[model samples]
Target: MRHLTQNWHVNILGFVLFLFTAVLLLIADNLSISYKEALTFYDEKNLLHYLSNLSVYFLGQSNIALRFPFILFYVLSVILMYKMTADYFKYESDRLISVLIFMFLPGIIGASLLVNNSIIVIFCTILYLYYYRTYNRHNYVLLFIFVFLDNSFAILFLALFFYAMKNRQNQLFIISLILFGLSMYIFGFDTFGKPKSHILDTFAIYASIFSPLLFLYFFYSMYRIGVKGKRSIYWYVSMTAFLFSFLLSFRQKIYIEDFAPFVVVTVPLMMKLFFHSLRVRLPRFRDKHYKVAALTLFLLFVNVGVILFNKPIYLMLKQSDDHFAYNYHFADEIAQLLQKSNIYTVTSNDYKLLKRLEFYGIHTDKKSTNFISIKPLNVYDKKFQIDYFNTNILNIYYVNLKK
Candidate 1:
């Protein structure tokens, strides 16, 4: 009865943590539509990001509603992360701490609110990994499903096949190879093309995501895991995947979603390493209760500091109008103005802005010669154009075309 009650309390605490994290993400600036989000909305390339588009299409196209699917997937991924951590680490506190760190990661938070396939991919990846680690059979179904989520995930099959081969799981290796071949046939071998050089930009992106301090800790943890841990294959696979993603990021336009797998796989390992270091260095602390309390408080402080102080995190939480492609605060007003004026046709060099306008129910006519061109009044044009909506973050002008 005592153990059961204690478990209940821990579960409740984890639920509360999830709720708090969700609320913060809900209120963050990234919840609004951005250029990348606009691309997802248009989806001209017909990529495998059907889930993201389908979610938006079914969810009423509202700013807040569009985020719900991603949030739901994000929560699911976090839960799976906890399960995976619990399975791997004996210490209950370490499991909880790992989940907490995942919840607070800036990359995870920002990615969760955007209309991108990354969150979904992360969720599927974690689920597949969790099942791979815990279940002895029926994991091939997950591999089959993952091929549809993103072509990049197909790389994981190679890692799994290698592991299976090394461990003498010949049946699993054969299945993985078959799936890999099928994925290649369907998704094509295009992802393996020559890499572009984005070495500096990629490094900058990683630095921003993990922050300099956390990145250092992550690197150190990877080093320790590779050198000391028996399950070194996991570390090698994770690093290889990260490198592949990093190199592929330059070959094409990749977003944070593309890096979600790398982040998901590494963060828990880093947390485990951190806790192990704590135990080793503070072995003299006699009171286990006090030690847990101190460590918990320290981690909470660090997470809070990261949220408040990190430049990207600060911007995400600030909720500025300029953060989005269309000024969300003034969206309804702009829509109303355009509708009232009977300005159905519009043109703009800023395609993202046009897409946002369209999402808000303002249609654009590319062929119409005399349509309104929405542009910044001061910056884009100094000529006499009717000012439609003007704000610190955005400016709109109604220019009459000579028909």
Candidate 2:
């Protein structure tokens, strides 16, 4: 097993798998900013994701090209997950199983493909955890990066504090606390209005992401493992973060995407418990080979079935095609319309449509030359004469900016 893991082909195969998934996501529709994400970006709610928006802006506003960086982050996240798992488990086969589980999980796949902060959070969290496990004097660099990247990562301080207390590293603990404070101050807290009493819905969302049956099995496995030892601190911290996020949602609505980091962090440990349980089977089964095989097949079937029927998977597939048809599919037509008309800026009441136009380089800024408003009379001055109007899937209007 060691020799097989050490083989150059193993790394090659992993890279090939990552590349295949990346390409599949790149081609998928709605890889561009979603409406919710667009609103956040436009409002400058989280500056950490500014890089993502900047990539879109710099790529000449092409949504397809914008997904390239995110795809790269997703690939790196998979690699980090493998490394973290290998660090936890001594065996190469165990590490490989953890990586495969992470790669195939519906939640991981959906988070990876979406153009949002979830992938960034997952990538940074894994990278930070890897550095934390291999703690060296230089590893503090990851802490700084994590804090600057996202305020939500402040949750990591809980684990760091525990580690510091256990190791008598008071200075490190103080430093992490300071960084957490700075992160909160810089990014500000995200508040989604008042929290809803949707605890059941929150659990359902998580189940949907991880698959209801698989998540139940994971919970059972975790209970059986019973946290202990220095390494168990990580698990406890991850669960704390997950529970905190879940509970916080009761007041300020946290989306499942927000829990991506915690979920991804706990996966390796869950798989560890699963593999451990398989090895320490009941003594009643003297010939355990067939039993083990059957159990493995059943688990695999459950996970695969969940992935195949996941609602987000179908939604993403359909949304991708729909977004392309309604948006990118009309790129050339919109561009031509703009080019022929004396319109340099276009305004729309629909923010999604406006952002899509901006992405297509249609100059949605009202300050630009040749401005035209596509909104109804209430939004634009009634005195601005309407030169032309077309109503289709997208409304286009050529209004006289002068008046």
Candidate 3:
């Protein structure tokens, strides 16, 4: 009977994952290509660039096609998370809850639908963990492969270095140090910017990723584990990334994408710490943790909801440009308005937007000489208010001819 209940819980999580995938597909369909994505699409070359190109080759150049690979990665990551939860959680329901939280994480959700390596990093990180726990020996082969993959895995190898040291695994520690060096050499850490502080900005980004209160708890969990609880390989990997990124932020703005994957994968660790603390307390005395956990979950849902239904947030912003998603919101609508005006094959001063427009069939030619300048209209204007919201989200774009 207990086994039956366990199977039922896992089955229900399976259903939730199915629905969540559909929602992600819908969100992908709605989002326009951002400047960064457009740059990646045309100018930049990488693994994601090739994969996205291949996806569009078969599925055609739609938003969903562009993002489908990452979405698939996200599904695999969720499955890996479920398998991972068994390591920390005794209760089937606890395992289910941990997996479910990982699925709805705002950072994970954003990564899964965007044209970047974040989702793949997450999938690979979890995959490595799953492999390390189960097979143990073959993980080095996986770690070797990670060297060429991304600079982000430097954090992974570094974490393993410490874990290996603690366990006195000489071979593992030496290999990890070599791999970490290779990753840095291949990727080349950027110290080009004048040294300044972006630690506050990094903190704000993390708050968004884990949601506010949960991020605090996540920090607390890591500190507590380091201070007292048993520090498993998982905690080491996560803490190493978290500490490395924030510490570097004081000198340079560290790329959160590189670090967030490792940190977020520690969800099971956080859950284990939370539950252990709660159970250790007297039932009547546990009210504080219960309330904090409830509030944390509430904040997580609110963050997820805000991310999924972000169109409404435009109304709250004092100006459209101030809207967090302004970059990813305008290109498709702009292309549609231009096509109606019979303006095809136009060039733009905005190179990134031009690349994005090109994806929507707005080709550019130097001989054609049509120039477009884009400006966002924050106020209500009768000119070219477009998009599904049927609000004044965008304004008229003036088209010109070169002299």
User: Which one is best on TM-score?
Assistant: 3
In model 3, what are the clashing residue pairs, if there are any? none
Give the Å shift of residue 276 in candidate 1: 1.7
Q: Where is model 3 poorest over a 10-residue stretch in terms of lDDT?
A: 376-385
lDDT string, candidate 2, 215-326, tens digits: 7765665566545423455565566566677778777766566565666567777777766666687756535645654575466557655443333333344233344223
Score each candidate by Cα lDDT: 0.62, 0.60, 0.85
Colliding pairs, model 1 = none
Ranking by lDDT: 3, 1, 2
Residue 369 deviation, candidate 3, in Å?
A: 5.4
Report backbone clashes per prediction. 0, 3, 0
lDDT of 3 by residue, 216-300 (tens): 9899999998999899999999999999888998988777998999999999998888778889889999999888889999999
Point out the higher-scoring one by TM-score: 1 or 3. 3
- Model 3's number of clashes is 0
Give per-residue CA lDDT, model 1, range 1-403, as digits (tens).
Answer: 8887779636765777667655755464233455555666676554424555676678666666656777787788888887776666757777776777676666676567666666777777777777766764537777887776566666677767777777778987898788878777887644332556565666666655565556656766766776787544456456656666666766754554455455556777777666666677555663663565466546545655555333343234333343322333444455556777666667766566677767667767776442433444543321222222332333356655552
RMSD of each: 5.7, 7.1, 2.7
- Deviation (Å) of 118 in candidate 3: 1.3
Error of 1 at 34 (Å): 3.4
